[model samples]
Target: MKSVDATEFRVGGSDGWTVTTSFNYNQWAEKNRFQVGDSLLFDYDSGKDSVYQVNKEDYDKCHTEKPIETYKDGHTSIKLDETGTLYFISGNCGNCRKNEKMVVQVMACRGSCNSAASLGYLSCLGVVGAFVASLLL
Candidate 1:
């Protein structure tokens, strides 16, 4: 996640999912599109106090039972496992009205087998290619 300002954050993909701090709920959701096995990181800003909570709809689908709290200038991580939409909000009362909510879209693998087998096959091919190259040398 990237910090845009004292009260803003952003997300980007490094080895995984990434996001940027959004000013509104809809903006956040559009920016950070979540997938299964992905995670969301909230990087809080200093001095500017804030609180974050997931939307009730998201909590129900994921069976996430937790209360919201004030956020610090660091990283808050949330993992996505199921396929659905996740929403979040800053519980900062008046501040919330000033654009302080986040959302994410989580998608699951489509087919039964999906791309797992394909990935494995590609890995095997890579190993074979390396071995053949070594033998030739």
Candidate 2:
């Protein structure tokens, strides 16, 4: 097994998660480098706000209903197991209308992340060799 050190992002930064203010989540995400295996920690006031994980279509459309997943414990931790784009929004319609949405891109895992792990990166050389042969033809 490989041990990967993941970063835990606190949604909404020091203010925690909420739509009470004109907080810029997109700005915060732009500064962070997210990768596979990282975790997101959403700390908010459950009584007032809720978290919803939705697909891009739902996120862009601001459809709060039928979320892919829902979290209301206020302190939620989500693991990024794959490299791709993730979309999140406030379950509250008012908040969603206020643009309480966030998107993050998880980067692909780097090779040989741990010193103890052995990688078969060289195994793909056969394909590379085939491509090089085509270039000669």
Q: Estimate each model's TM-score.
A: 0.47, 0.76
The CA lDDT of each predicted structure is 0.48, 0.79
lDDT of 1: 0.48
Error of 2 at 120 (Å): 16
lDDT of 2 by residue, 4-90 (tens): 677888888888778756688878888898877678999988999888999999998889878989999989999887888889999
Model 2 poorest 10 in a row by lDDT: 114-123
Stretches of candidate 1 off by over 4 Å are: 1-22, 56-73, 109-137
Clashing pairs in 2: none
Q: What is the lDDT of residue 117 in candidate 2?
A: 20
Q: Model 2's lDDT to the true fold? A: 0.79
Best by lDDT: 2
Best by TM-score: 2
Stretches of candidate 2 off by over 4 Å are: 1-3, 114-137
